[model samples]
Target: MSLVRSAGLQKFRQSVEALGGDPEVYARRAGLPVDALDSDELLVEDSALAAVLEIAAADLGCPDLGLRVGRAQDFGMLGPLAVAIQHSPSVADALACTSRYMFVHARDLSVALVEDPDGSHGVVGLRYSFSAGKRPLPQATDMTMLFLHRAVEFLVGGRYGLRSVDLPHQPAAPRSRYEDAFGARVRFGRDAALLRVPSSLLSRPLDGVDETLRRLALAFLSQQSSEARPLVTAKVRTVLDQSLGTGSTELVDVARALAVHPRTLQRQLAAEGESFASVLDSVRRARARTYLTTTDMPLSQVSDLIGFAEQGVLSRCAQRWWGRTPSALRQEARSRARPRA
Candidate 1:
């Protein structure tokens, strides 16, 4: 009964259509929500996705369909999780973040760094698996493994020293296809989906690491993780933060971002003793405080950044929230930051 984010199916429709099959037909036959295909906002049953993938592979006679789909997808499919991983200091840290928060993508999927199967020194194993019951999911497994390899490739900006790939199920595609996908030797009928890498590569640093963006992205993912069991308010606040400057902070827009109906979003917020306007104002106030204190940006620019239409509006809000003008607040912040003489 575990759910997977539909982003996992990023190229599903086009991939199916390219193979001359109706994507909707495959989805419906497998009990999948047809509308959720290739979407990021909705969750689908993991088993249903596995079923559709197997069905498509069988009908299209394309055993490597999963690999194709996986190959086409990039880190952007991961949304904020990608941002967090990309900014990680090292490849190992990125993998660790993925392993810890992958439930934000799929509840029953596991990605871990493990010991090499052959007890080989100076080698490490990266394993990927789905807990989708006894039913064989060669296609989904292939796709996910290829995805993991590609993700690491993106992180390290190249091949990542892959030595071999091992899968639990027999090759759905030709052995060469799997090997080609990973650019390494492919072994079938093994214990799990594992990629062997030189242990040294584990410590390789990622380029363009940004501590601030990484912290923000990790905070967002942590809030979205199942362990957080986040309330509707948190979700709404997150959507607001992303959409604030875009002039789309309406209830409908936030609800759409969350894949929920407006009324449903409102009702959930009300159940928690909140409302959309109140949340929006709270977000604005917090953002205002951060901008006024941290940077010397002009009031007009700060107004736009926080979703207000004019500087006058920001001035009024500053008065309401802190009983002072935005300029006065910024001056006070500057004074506090100054060294005492």
Candidate 2:
């Protein structure tokens, strides 16, 4: 069972009720015991909870219901801080303030406003670095992006959408749902999940402002750090790094590198919601893209650098991983690098 502790629980319940579902029934479907739903403990873990949310959304005829719930929850938890941002002089300041306060309850996530050097625009991106035994699932990342997109839209009262949405896993279902939810080009199987929004949106005015609320929110966030890293993730990353550039990468190699038996490493990684295959694939895919785009090196040479035995094998894997051919990827990279008219 996975644990869940959302600061927006009350708001989530209200949203569910508004959407025409009994909160108790929703909680029960989510696998939470009856008392667990009403208790003030603020933490519960039952796979059924996520399932319940999905089912509730489907029943309510809101394909974006999950997104709506997430936004309400985020707003309930961060509204005061958001109001303070609304009073700020510029979008940049608002984003910086929001980013600071948003982490109060969820320090596992990071948000940044990255400005383009040419002064064209900026991007607001989110990064999640999970603690040991707590890597987020792909659905969780998608839900978070959906919430952020909706919250920004609510703040601006405009049809705001991401410039790009990046994910670490390939799409498991039809692509239309992703397209409908994000309204942006989605890139999957990448190192980290990211949702890129225009920098200008950061400067837009918010609907409320309250200094006291901001202060309170900041205080609350300061007290929460359950998302901090554990030594395990660092070790896993290290093992992955060393195993790359060699065709001998395997579970055994990872176990030996971490000074544990293979089974122990497997169990530990499983606890963290990852497997050796997933980590290795991430490392190779990231390195492959870096080599392909950053250098004029031939595809075969790039394959060698990333530990592929043959260019053909690398090409096949890259296509499956990125949904694009090598030549097409290179062309797209060049186009992105070109100067705008």
Candidate 3:
């Protein structure tokens, strides 16, 4: 059984109760020591805890209900840190700094920046990677995602939402919760999960900085560190290659398949100065180039082969990556391929 301090446990129970679930029943089914459940400290098996939460959510007909609880508790911890970073001189620096600070308590997760040639900046994305014996519960990961989504909203004052959200599972459930929380296009059955945001939105200056609050947040982050890497470019490349034929990849599934906590995986990638989304973009660009020059496959088929949601998204990405449309690129390649006549 995994034992956590009572304070944290109580908060979790309260969240469950708020969702109209019976805390005592959940505690019992999750194998919490009866006395421990009532005490200030709690001991419960991780798998059991995960199962209880999942069953509760399913019963409520809201696979994302746990997410709501997580957001309320965790976003409060993250908001000030996000604000501090947002108030930094530029989005680039803000993101870099945020990544450093955000990982202290949440060492399993990571944040990174993605810059297109046109000066558009994306959050790159966030994800978790677990180490061996530390698989994160889906409820836990979902909750973390909720906190992240809400924190971003808090930072931007709700001006925008995520551009896209990717999940590693088949997406049989949690569709509505994802939609409600992210309000963006959701893709499941992908190798690595992602949350994409428009580059333009990153430029908005924050309201102001609170040095005292910022220091507290940074201090909190400073207290923790773990030596795991989830967003490694190599890992991302491998996953993309594997998904080329499947046409769908889920980030959570990849984390599970890799036998690491999703957040840990993300932190490792952040430490490496890369993100899953950035790596995916790189892979897509590389593949596009190769297919344009070496294969006679039509653009649409090529786009699908590379796991793009649509040819239009592929076209836009190609233009951004190479400063030319797919056809233009193909024509250019063909021209170069022709021998002297």
Candidate 4:
């Protein structure tokens, strides 16, 4: 179950009002709580919010409604998540923090740093799904992509020099709305939504990053991490995500951190019809797929990030899993992610 952040909805309401539309009318008409967006802590159902956005847009006679909502969003709208990201050392650190702690915002909102092949360009792919195995509404998607871009602008000084915006669905709103807001080409009906950026931008230290705020936010996020969310399985996944890059995702190490015996952890996982090795493999596959498609990360780095000893190991795994070598997988992924005609 994924929960959406209330801030985006709040922006929708604001945008509606700014355009002389009645937000209350749309809220009531859409079967939503009129004040839901006003509450910062409230986590909303993405599906319901999507429906509301669609209805609100149509009711207001605004095709760029979602784009407006996104363009208006600021870092403060992200609440604590914004604090954490803003205070981080650099854009890369911010993205890592987001990936680690995003469960608090949305159950399945994923933000990642994807470097392009040969160290050319990199992108940050923002993928959000309210429910498992289901895509989110087009309005919601547009709002999120644009809002995140704005958030980046607030963090840095410029537009983050975005290369393009890759949207999964065809334009529900006007194409110019996206292009104007992004200041970049807008490609629709792609495989996923991403913000293409320069690889060099990831390391640029954010100006005026408050160390105190960053420390405080990190402490808060530690207590509220995904580990504390649902089950032991969730904790394991979180640990795996954090440890993969270090080449240390062993179950024993994980269980040791939890202060549990390896056997005890194994037994717990077995009760859920899973195993430590299985869980590790699952995490690896998920990370590998994201890296292969979203980034131009070299195969060697990808191998290291996913806990393979070397590049060939990752190649073997890819061959077994996707029936394609790493290069082929990357090619196929790029092809799929390309905008449709």
Candidate 5:
């Protein structure tokens, strides 16, 4: 439902190859073409990128794949967004660049800075949100957190300053794995995903601020943004993910929540070469695969969570999504997660 730059997929390829594994084999298992490496210009479907990273992590037996990939990346890979941020005068300006122009690089995901109202200290942090809910990027959250720290440090080098971090999901490994990787205290099951730092550091200047490129990047970004269509499909997917199991995944309800007429929303989707039912089905399939492969919940519960009428309807949908039964997918997930003796 959203377009993702193939940078994540590219980095995964590099990581897999470093492990002496064939990246194409892993990618094909996740329904992506080996030719994904052919063009850095190519964009991938958001759910496909998630599936690829999730499966690749399992195949290579690297539970910390996202963190590893994020560690290796620099800002140059971030496309136009990187260009805009690299010349910013301060960390705050860089974050503002991300908040405004991140959509140019990645869809469905948003990044922003927020000051901590509760903290006595000068606490501010970056927060991440998924346009299609938490289900969209199950494996990418850690990567994004690491990227945030690295991108800022690429400007003002220091302790990679972070006060604390929180994630919405449970940990896949031991607490030490996270704390060691992040160099910060980490907590899970948080209401949101955030990485907090001192508000005073926000004004720290970059190493080499370029006045000329900054103005040029701003001009290009402004032009691209004006012509850019609002991510109506992304919003629709988000609403549908939240609405499922609550009441209806109906178009009218989603449109109303977005504060637009249903037909107007349909027109926007049409411009983007999407439809309401297609977006709903995309979110449902992504959630189904994620829940099936990650959690041990029964198929009946999965059905209810994704708003399927019953297990039978879910069975048909699962078969279409993964070419296997829900049980088979779960079994495969568990098998891949098992440690080799």
Candidate 6:
């Protein structure tokens, strides 16, 4: 499964309890261990993290749950990654560092600077996306978007040239909620989640950057990444997770992404006692469970998102995998998520 550091849930418990919902109850419903958020070093499934946020939002009657939690978090939650970023000489350097080492935080999440998304000059889009089977739930997107906004503010103080925020999905909460959280014009129903900023801001040097500290922090992160480098099976799982929704789940496409010959990739999986098809099924199963338990999405939509051509295919697979129909699985999940009096 695609995993992320528990730091993503920095204020999760407080946000849930503030809204009068039990964090533990919601965590359990989303297949996360109750203590998942207790340590930043701990790893949890990325989908589970997303699910817990969405579940808490729905159960606690808080439509702006992601924004609330995100507003309470700062760069410190990123731990060593924060230190390295803070010590970068320029905003562009920091963003490059973030893009490179973010995998140390969340394997499935990606962020980058894109030039002129709307074909405008001197503007850059800081885009956030998940390499998972499909786009994340709205609450997850909201949380990340707000966090990115806050991080830039921390780096440059109040002078950060944030123009607007773009969101992929339509408003899940009020437009004012997004505007208040971002402190900028917020546009919804966009192609990607982005933070628009003047490109010149990228070259502005940060105040009090310490080159020595930055190097040390980078060394620590480099060593950590080396130690945590996943096996071939794990790598294949990540590729499959992203490919499932795109109809390119074939082995050759995955091999191309990995820069390996198909035969070479097949042999490596064989050495790990796995096959490409098996890995794809595993990713689909995990995504299926997540979608069923955490979302009210229709069965047909869920099927399409998981790369099945028809709802009946999903139903049959669900029965084979879990001895229940997809509808039955969803009903059970809903029943279990209801709060006790």
Q: Report the number of the highest-lDDT candidate.
A: 6
Backbone clashes in model 3: 27
Using TM-score as the measure, the top candidate is 1
lDDT-best of 4 and 6: 6
**What is the C-alpha lDDT profile of model 3 across 57-143, one tens digit per residue?**
766576665566655554434444555665565444566776776543343345555432223355445443433346455665565
Write down the TM-score of every candidate. 0.68, 0.47, 0.49, 0.62, 0.64, 0.67
| Greater-lDDT candidate between 1 and 5 | 1
lDDT of 4 by residue, 1-341 (tens): 45555565867767886776666556656654444555554445667777788888887788788888877766686677789898899988988888888777777677765543224435444444344557777888888888888777887887677777788899986788789988999898876677777766778999888989988888876776554443565567668878888746777899987889999999877754568887787678867876877689889999988878889999998988778898998897566556658
Q: Write the residue-wise lDDT of candidate 1 on 247-318 in tens digits.
A: 599899889989999999898888656789988987788678768877888889999999887899999999
Worst lDDT window (10 residues) for model 3? 1-10
Sorted on TM-score, best first, the list reads 1, 6, 5, 4, 3, 2
Model 5 lDDT per residue over 1-341, tens place: 56766675547767776865556556657755344543343356767777776887777787788787778776787776687798998888988887888776776678887766346477886788778445445467777777777776677775856888888878865778788878899888877788888888878887788878988888877765524544676688668868887868888888889999999999998876688888788778767766877688889999999988789999998788768999998897777567658
Whole-model lDDT, candidate 4? Answer: 0.74
lDDT of each: 0.82, 0.60, 0.59, 0.74, 0.75, 0.84
What lDDT does candidate 5 reach at residue 198?
84
Ranking by lDDT: 6, 1, 5, 4, 2, 3
Question: How many Å off is the CA of 163 in candidate 1?
Answer: 0.8
Off by over 4 Å in 1: 132-136, 227-341
- Tell me the lDDT of model 6 at 207: 94
lDDT of 2 by residue, 245-289 (tens): 764677887777778999988777676556777667666775676
Runs of candidate 3 with Cα error greater than 4 angstroms are: 1-15, 31-52, 58-61, 78-94, 113-123, 132-137, 172-174, 223-341
- The alpha-carbon deviation from the true structure for residue 236 of candidate 5, after best TM-score superposition, in angstroms, is 24
Error of 6 at 189 (Å): 1.4
Best of the two (2, 4) by lDDT: 4
lDDT at position 28, candidate 4: 53
